[model samples]
Target: MNKPKYGPPHHSASPRYTGLRTYMKLPNVNDPHELNDADIAIVGLPFDTAASYRSGARFGPAGIREISMLLRPANAFHKINPFDYCSVIDFGDLPLIPGHIHDSYDVMKEAYRQFAKHNVVPIGLGGDHSVTLGELRGLAEVYGPLSLVHFDAHGDTWDNYWGKKYTHGTPFRRAAEEQIIDPNSSIQIGLRGTVYSPDDMDAAKEMGFQILTAEEARELAPKQLSEAIRSRVGNKPVFLTFDIDFFDPAYAPGTGTPEPGGFTSVEGLSFVRHLPLVNYVGFDLVEVLPALDQSEITAQLGAAIVYEFITIMALKNRDGKT
Candidate 1:
């Protein structure tokens, strides 16, 4: 068990957490960017009109924000207070056009475009993996070709999923095909399970993404894992896309898609922490369906990922200029 510092426990009878609202209030995404102001915009995109199985991922952004409010001020591994170095704003959810897939993407794309213009780093709570497409579109529009450090159980490299295109399963493929992302510099980690076709796996390789299976990761020491991640990401702008289903179902039972025998929550964090700062750029935490969970373990784990990203930002900001 993790030992607490000084504040009242999370389950204490005190008034701090027993209220109707539990999360801390940060600035809204609509706030204008000042000349020297730097902020992390935490936006939620609840559009999940294309989910094939579970549909509650539309509720993920709110659930993650609620948990963030419940989190204490101290960082677990880094021991750094987030308020010391930067500011975070809860930009609320992106508006989605109802009943239209492409229209929904356009709405999210515009929101990202506005955030990018302000030089704000977006830490999004996703509706589905498809939100990555819109977010990447904005980033690529500004920064040109980038690399990816994708943590998930599926390759997400299918050309087309189901009868139509633009599902969560095809975003990376679309991005790579458009040359917005350099697959040669990208890394897809923790791939396991039979979620898609064999051809999809080949597409990831053919498109130039380096795929690291869970079994291979486990076989190597922690140092090797970090080295492999660094080698794949190289010296390009990196986008960190974390899918909750990347963890085993036992650790994350509240996701829309639960692949058994996947990496545990601890393993996922280890993978994230190993990614070096030279290539790091942005991140997203996606696909936590609170409707399926009452214990809130998945939500708490999602909060952990946000914390990891915060530490990365602190380190990056400290070193990037000097």
Candidate 2:
């Protein structure tokens, strides 16, 4: 077998905990020109100012990286070594301004726009769920409006928070308003918990999003859920955003606004694994606050989910779908 062009060094050759932390210990390449040969770029967007509840998710990127060293290169369930199929790198954290959302959004959008120009798929380790809006802005410039596959315990479609339009709870609504994501082709899963009004979930439906509440999701098997998601988002450029809080607070307590009655780690992973291979442009996993994390279990699970995202891309590449 031919050796992989880029990947983490074997654990036997280099100790896991010995170096500057990067996702899976992959090489760090910050220059966009250098991305020409890379297939995937794992980036950290460490801006949590938009978080309305507990802060400190600004450190989420570092937390995920610190624990990501434990991940291996191969994906057993997908039956393909991801690194063998594609060259992936840790692009390091994107720049962000503390307590400044609009400026940070501009910076983040431009950075992602550059990556999109290079055709390198970015997997963002997020600062908060709101960071996804910047990612979508950049990517939509290149891919047009994208289909959204959102997993979270909250609808996150509120028009505004305290008269502010750009909080973590309102990115999707803004994404819809800005025409960055095509709501007609989008689907939100795992929405549960009390809301300000009954119209909260209904509002998303009114905007053309297909939502499956946490209760509704529990009724369907993982395969069944994936089928429902595929049927809703048929043949569109997809951008998947997962809030760590999509799982129960018992499993992912490190998030800012975690709710109960969610999926288990196995169940969450299974749902992602069964996702129908479509035109995927980008992905992000958000809301991991290490300070609240118990034993970094949430971070570890976040890393594993990102790994699954890479595995999916590798599978797509192997099948000549990209």
Candidate 3:
């Protein structure tokens, strides 16, 4: 087979700890020419000022990358090495302002728009859930309205927080309003936690999102759960967003919001693994706060989940589905 244009160096060439700490040690590039060669690009979205409960998710991108070096090319379950079929790169982080959500959103939208122009599928390491709203704006410019598959402990559909229309807990509602994501074809899984009112839950459903509370998710087998996602999403261009807090606090404690009744990491992986074929346009994993993570377990789980996404991309290429 011909060599892939871009990939992480083999372990024999250099130690994992010796690199500049780009995700999986892939070449970190910013030039348009270099960016053009990649099929999948790992980019960071490091702005978390919109978070309501806790801060420091701004460091989530760095925290996930710092531990991602431990990831290997081969996925044991997929029985294939992703790098063999796709060119991957670390494109570094999109530009952001520290405390400005709307300004950061503009910059992120333009940056991600460039990725879409180049036909690159961005797997983002996020600063907060609000980052997805910007990403959707950018990608929707290229791909119209997208179907959403959201996994989180919260619905994130609140209309406002503290008189503000945009916050970490309110991106999905904003996205639906902007018509960047079509809620009719969307599904939000693993929503479990206390809310301000019953209207909070009703809001997401009224907007046409198929809601699966954490308890409801636990009732279905992994395959059944995945099938439900596929059935709802169908063949639409789907963008997936995963909040690290979707897992139980015992499994992922370093998050802005912690909920007690959530699934285990193992179960989360099973759901991703069994996800059926669909037109996946992009993915993001958010809300990993390393300052709150004493053991880096949350970061570890975050990296693992992103790796599964990479595997899915590779499997698509291998099967000629891309």
Candidate 4:
């Protein structure tokens, strides 16, 4: 008989912690066909088999969703209420086959494909950086050769790890090789810490990705850094991928690979706020391993990051900019 409703439930009368843990307390729309009218679909990807270090990021999506219940409808900084402008829903987690990277990727790609087909922007709560490759594949089918705006503490463009090509360490390299992302238009921000060799940076450079080390980002004003990123991607259909480790360990300690030097939470938010001008096709916030986190700060930050992304979408829709 009747079709199921989509988007969030009105929770103003209910306490934030009183409902099922969904992103922004949105309604859980289990069926893909129900997502047709939604402006944004939130999906949890709980696969971390490709992690090189810690394995607990498989809980990242749930962690972020639990924390996201505290998120309000309005964004004070942007002066827009996301729900007032667009419909957003939690699509629940993709049923990933754990311990099998390729199979997981196949599943992720197909899940994202449904969102793309419906013209819904997918904000993925990640399992790890490797999950991004699958997301890129799905979006590429809808919008070919996306421009990439990558925020992370590592380049993630290593050719392989222990001869395995699908590790979290090599997702972007795979994306580049597959031509899923247009490297000339893509840029990597917040790269820092030790690498296998100096050639690590060289490899990313050779791949045509403009690299901005954490040190370099620190040197620029927030506005300047945001401007630099916006100029590079420049109106291309961009897939914005943020690894939680992009923030300093003090702010986001629950990542698989904790890099020492990274951006502050405010700085990270500034970059995301500046991105509403871009034609974003998809977004993901990855690598939040709650088992390693203290006081759930990493999960809190992860939820906030997704909040800003949705705020951007709301602002764009309100202004008729996208």
The digit string of per-residue lDDT tens for model 3 on 222-308 reads 889989988998888999999999999999999999999898988999999888768988999999999999688999899999999
RMSD of each: 4.9, 1.2, 1.1, 2.6
Worst 10 residues of 4 by lDDT: 1-10
Candidate 2 residues lying further than 4 Å off, grouped into runs, are 1-4
Q: lDDT tens string, model 4, 1-322? A: 1222454666667988888898978878868778777878888999898999888899999999888888777788888767777788888999987889888889888888888899999999989899999999998998899999999999899988899999999999999999999999999989999899978988888889999999888887767877887889888999999999999999999999999878888888887776646799899999999899998899999999999888888778778785
C-alpha TM-score for every candidate: 0.88, 0.97, 0.97, 0.96
C-alpha positional error of residue 207 in candidate 2 after TM-score superposition, expressed in Å: 0.6
Where does model 3 exceed 4 Å of error? none
Off by over 4 Å in 1: 1-24, 32-36, 320-322
Candidate 2 has a TM-score of 0.97
Task: Give the Cα error of residue 156 in candidate 3, in Å.
Answer: 0.5
lDDT of each: 0.73, 0.91, 0.90, 0.88
Model 2 per-residue lDDT tens digits across residues 135-171: 9999999989999999999989999989999999999
Error of 1 at 168 (Å): 1.1
Model 2: lDDT of residue 194: 81
Candidate 3, residue 306: CA error in Å? 0.6
lDDT of 1 by residue, 240-302 (tens): 899888888899898877888887777778767665766555689888888996588888788
